[model samples]
Target chain A: MSRGDWASWLESWRQQLVLWLESTPAGDFVNTYTWAWPIAESFHFVGLCLLLGTVGLFDLRLLGFARQIPLPQLHRLIPWGIAGFSINAATGSLFMAAAPFQYLYNESFYFKATFLSVAGVNVAVFYLLFYRKIVPLGAGEQAPWPARIIGGVSLLMWIGVMCAGRLLTFYRPSFRFF
Target chain B: MDPVFIWLEQTALSVWVRESPSMFAFPGILTLHTIGMAFLVGLTSAFSLRILGFARRVPAPEMLKLVPVVWFGFFLNLVSGFLLLLAYPTKALTNPVFYLKLTTIALALLAVRALGRRVADLSFRPVRGWPGDRVLASLTLGFWVVSVTAGRFLAYTHSRLLASDF
Candidate 1:
């Protein structure tokens, strides 16, 4: 598509999304309640902690940070991390619905979303390609280079997500193109 | 307290933390604070869950290696949190919820220490843990949740934005 066509298409899509989200009760709860925003924010932080704790720790183990931890024993913690991710997804969607324009137009939101995707894909790659290799390695064994790289990527991506999420409020997109 | 806030607010460091245009100022520090929080609470909670029988096969003593990292996280938060307090003295000190946040942190710290001592006791061995360790772990988790809630509420509950605002 031409540049102008792309921009117009984006504009129309954004407007429609805003119209749809504005009607959702998630936005209404956020807009109408006094404590709703802060509470959601708290839960979001909690979820991030849980994710970092289980999944992040597992990453650290893969990177050979805490070598004393048995890989399978530590892998048990992944479920809690999944739960954390679910909580964040729910709250994060609620936030976008609450103020669609704030997120859709913000550059930081784009970066955050990209980082989240990288983290997600990185997980998939680890489980599909690298899981079997790490399963046999007992405590204090060095993880292969592939696992280490994946762990490093996961750590950096999550940190990037957090940084971009924090900066979202600061970057209000003043668009002349769209 | 008001006089103390007024004086602290005008200090050069406080001024820089509050008004610096650099992202390294308020935004960077807040981000660091959050990262510290994730590591500190996350690692501790994971350790606690293990003791609570969530990950039973993992030997308890080996997990003690994580203590230093948890303390490192705590150190990061302590420094960042202090800088944040310096930036907006009255904003935090005046809010009752701020006090609540502090109290919860104190309680959480105590719970953490107790839990750690119990875990360390399990060193070089694996047993059911100390008699009350499960209760201690549960309390630690609860305190962390309360602390996190209180910390988030601090932004919304403060009546004063700056010492000078009053």
Candidate 2:
């Protein structure tokens, strides 16, 4: 689709989000849940730390650091990583729910969401495409070249998500532009 | 405090950081600051959990080996953070939340170092039945999370934009 077509589609999404957001009262206690936003934001950051830390460690292993550690042993950390991701998704939704138009229309937020989705898909693809062959290969065996490539791509995609999320404030979309 | 602020503002790097017209001057530096935060906070949390015995199978020392990478991320954030402060010394210096963020980071770093040394002590293997490991792991994760969230709040809670305003 052309850029214009994509923009139009995004605009429709933004409109729907606006309607949903407006259904709530402007002074809704949920919006002003004094403790809630900061607490949720904290949880979100915690999740980011967990996700990045565990996943980054695994990627480093694939890239050949801590060669003595078994991949399965390292993989044990993945569940905690998933827990962190769950926290972020939950908190992120609250932020959007509180101010849908601000985020839905924001270019950086859009890019962040897009990158996150790509990273998620990449993780799924990594497991679906290579898990069985790699897992049975066992401890001390070098990761297959394909798995290493996947690991590298996963790292890049996550870092992209981080950068985009960080840059969100800088690229706040003008509400008037819509 | 005023004199100290004045002296800081007079520093050549601070002057450039505040006065430079290039995007690389302010906005670029801010972007780097946030990226560094993600890496630093993220890696710290991960390493903390590992140190606390979250993954008993992976050798604790092996997890400690990631320290250099975490430090690299920390350094990136430190430098970027300083640049951001230089750009608006008054903005950060006057903000209670900014100070809280700094203090939180300091505590988190200390916790990481202390935990790292403990984890490195090859004699200190995990006891199968003891809950010490789990408690330590939870504390490490908790501290890093608090630090990151406090850091995020700095943007929202600053008291002043410039010295002149105050």
Candidate 3:
């Protein structure tokens, strides 16, 4: 699609999101959720740490650091990482529901979402391609080249997600700005 | 303590952080703090899990080397976090959630340091068949995760925004 088409499409989505957000009564307990936003945001950050912590270690290992650690054992951390991602997704949805237009129209938010999607796909691909081969291997076994490539890609994708997420506030494109 | 808070509120750095027109001032600092949290908490939890025997092939002591990387992240957050606190001393100090966050962080750091010291004493080889060691590692990892969660909640739960009556 052309840039204009893409922009229009995005704008329509933004409008729909804003309508949904506004439909909820502002004074409703669910709307305010008595400290829900902060709590969810906190959980989001916590999840980020958990996800990154577990995945980053395995990626580092694939890059050949701490060679003595078995891939399977290190892979044990993946469940916690997945749990963290789940927390983030839940909290993130709440934020979006709370202030849909603000995020939907924001360029930084767009980039963050794009990066997050890419990271998710990268992770899925990693497991699909390498998990079977690597899981049953003995300790100290070198990761296959495909696994190494997947690890490297996963690392880059996540770092991109982090940087883009951090840059969101800086790059928000408001309607006024447009 | 109130006087100290009042004085901090009047400090030049605090004034600039809170009042500067540039988004780069407060917003940028907040962004940096978040990023630092990602790396610091991320790497520390990773290393802590390694110590707990999550990745046995990775020598426990070797994982200690990643400690420096984790510390680098922690230092970044420390600086950024202090800047944030300085900007609004009362906002943080008066908030129950902030205290919880601080306490959680302290526990996480203590667990990490204690675990690191133990890891450092070990040889590169795995210390096989010690269940307690794994438990310690798991707890250390869990503590850091909880700390991160608590810290995030601080933003939601703070009761006050500034030190002044105005």
Candidate 4:
């Protein structure tokens, strides 16, 4: 599709999806409870730490930064990173459902989603192409070139995601509540 | 309004940070601060977990290789945090939670340094006498949790957003 056509198509879909989200009970819950939103935000930050600490650290190791920490052993910390991602996904959904249009039409939100997708693809690429080759590598050994590229991409994508996420409030496109 | 804060709010740098329409001012600084928090807290917690014996096979001393990265995050935060404080002097200065956040970070770093020394003291043998190290690890973890919590609370708990608002 042409760029204009794609943009229009996304705009209509965003309108319809946001309308549906406005009717969700989850949205009402977040709006009704004063403390709920802030608490969830706190958890979101906490999860960010966990994800960056574990997964980001693993990425740095793959880039040959911490050579003595064995890759396979360090991989053990990834489950916790997954847990962090789960927390962020759950809390992130609440924010979206609470005011879908706020994000659906927001330019920064678009950037955030794009970066998130890139990060996901980076992970998929790593596991599919480089995981087997890099898994058995011992401490002090440099990861292969492909693995380093994935690691670098993972870090950049995540940082992009974070920047866009933080800019969401500033880029809300519409002033209407629903 | 307090004179210091009033003077601070009127200063060119602070005013630019708070009032400038440019995204690179407030939003960019805040984003950097959050990124730094993740690196500093995340790496520190990872090291703490290792010290607490979570990843037993990973060589403890080798983990210290991450110390410089952690410090990079720390310095990033220090600068970004100062910019934020300058942006809203009254808001952060008056809030008790802000002080608590600083204290928590200080304590956590102290714990991390002590633990680092303990790790460096190890001689590439099987780990031993780790009870104290574990205790320090737990303390560091607790401090970071509190620090992050306090930092998050500063937004809600602040009685004023600007000196004039109060």
Candidate 5:
């Protein structure tokens, strides 16, 4: 529970993770092939667009942008957003596997993870708590304050996730301590 | 071309874009570019999906209001993209992929504009008509994929980093 204990634990885990990941097939594929990295990066960009397009637009509607689109109707696009998220998750894991240290201690990566978590929790809350409430509302009707707040937060969180993700390379951590 | 790039690169704005330690410089501009891509491609993709019958309950007309937002995304990218180009005139100017990216973006913008009209008096049924809705939707999606991919490839494909390198 002390600072020293936590630091040591992190240090050991980082070493183990790096060692394990370096030996992975995903790691080998990425490391062996020249095109692997760029290919994955391309897919990652596409997936993010898909996500922001469907889900982000829905979020905008909830925030009263283009209020004419019915909430329930617009909700249909969430599945595509899920598909986009799935692609990114797969490619993102590959990236992290290929170069574990690039992300493990990077401040941008940490911020990205935090924003991703916030977005995830925000989605759950929207569906469980606010989704059904907005369902009955028809075209041009304004969403309740809760829905609007959730929408605003969702947008901000996604934008945060994106900004953090984009800044990952700029904030690559130094391994001098190791 | 090299002379112009050299001149541009030597400008204070371009220098800051390339060498500044501030996050608002290259890092922030790139982040803004990503956000623009998300919104530009995102809103249009949403509209395109609706056109493709992904969301049947939603009236296609209701979604047209968001087109301006899509344009807003394009505007953001245009400014951020120019700033990016300003930062590295030689890198982009020297690469064939850069031209591909610009052309692809131009095509994609056309597709977006055409879709606007095609969806104006839209119908869901398979009607034999001029520039089918599904076709335009598919084109928009396809053009975007190419543009986004080409945009990413621009980073790796550039042979020259600066005019001075020549």
Candidate 6:
């Protein structure tokens, strides 16, 4: 199909998806409670702190900032970061479930998803390509060039994620764009 | 204070922040505030985790390297937060939750300072079982939780969106 056709097709698909999402059980729960949405948002911000603190710190270590900390040891904080991500994923889903069309059609949602995917790919690259090689490095040692590069990319991607996430509300789709 | 909030809200900077259609205005400031919160709370949590013995092999003093990052996030939030308040002075100032958030942050920062002092004073010792240090770390973590929660609720609990709106 041509680009215009594809775009319109996707737009129609999104409208249908939004309608289905609005009928889900989670959507009802989120919309019915006066405080539920705000509470979920509170948890989301808290989770963000946890994720950034642990994951961002590890990234800094890779870039040679905290030279005295062992890489393996510092890596222990990753679970907390994962916990943060989990909280965000849950809360984020609730937001989408509450008003599917808002995010389904929002440009900022697309940016946030793109950044999130980039971060996922960066993590895969780190573990699949370089984790074994860089794991044995001790405190005060410089990570390999590849590790440093991964660290830099991870930082940028996560920052992009934060920026895009914050921009979500601003880009609530008005349905006119579709 | 009422007059002050009213006056502040009318300033060109504040008016632009509230009224501008550009994403660079309110949205950008909020984005900066959130990014800062993540780093500030996240880096601090890492230090607390170390004090609580999650990563025993990491020398405690080495974690001090992250203090600068914590400060960087804190300052970023301070500036961005001020801009947000400038944009909607009455909205935040009238909300009790906003004050709670500020108080929580102040305590959290103090906890951070206390933890940093203990970490700096360590003679490169393993920080596995220091009861006092652990307490400080735990308090810092708890305060950050409260701060983030209160900050989040500011959007929901505000009684007024503008000086005259209420």
Predicted structure with the largest TM-score when compared to the true one: 6
Which parts of model 1 are misplaced by more than 4 Å? A173-178, B124-128
Candidate 1, residue B147: Cα displacement in angstroms equals 0.4
lDDT of 6 by residue, A30-75 (tens): 9999999989998998888888888889899999888988887888
Q: Judged by lDDT relative to the true structure, which candidate is superior, 1 or 4?
A: 4
TM-scores of chain A across the candidates, in order, are 0.92, 0.86, 0.85, 0.94, 0.94, 0.94
User: How far does residue B38 in candidate 2 sit from its true spot (Å)?
Assistant: 3.2
Looking at the true structure's interface, with contacts defined as alpha carbon pairs within 8 Å between chains A and B, what fraction does model 1 recover? 0.76
Which stretches in model 3 have alpha-carbon errors above 4 Å? A1-6, A20-32, A124-153, A166-178, B21-23, B47-58, B122-135, B138-142, B164-166
Weakest ten-residue segment in model 5 chain A by summed lDDT: A169-178
C-alpha lDDT of candidate 6 relative to the true structure: 0.88
Candidate 3 lDDT over B56-111, as tens digits, reads 55566666656666777788889999999999999899887677778777777877
Task: Please give the TM-score that candidate 6 achieves against the real structure.
Answer: 0.96
User: Candidate 6, clashing residue pairs?
Assistant: A53-B42
Q: What would the per-residue lDDT of candidate 5 be over residues B27-70, giving only the tens digit for each residue?
A: 99999999999999988887887777788878776678888888
Output the worst ten-in-a-row residue range by lDDT, candidate 6 chain A: A169-178
- Residue pairs in steric clash, candidate 1? none
Task: For model 6, report the TM-score of its A chain.
Answer: 0.94
lDDT of 6 by residue, B22-86 (tens): 99899999999999898899898888888899878888788888888888999999999999999
How well is each residue in B12-129 modelled by candidate 1, as lDDT tens digits? 9999999998988998999889989998999988988887877787777677677887898899999999999999999999899998888888888898788788677656255445
Q: What share of the true interface contacts does candidate 5 keep?
A: 0.89
Worst 10 residues of 1 chain B by lDDT: B122-131
Number of the top DockQ candidate: 6
Q: How well does candidate 5 match the true structure, expressed as C-alpha RMSD?
A: 2.1
The TM-score between candidate 2 and the true structure equals: 0.85
Poorly placed runs, candidate 6 (over 4 Å): A175-178, B164-166
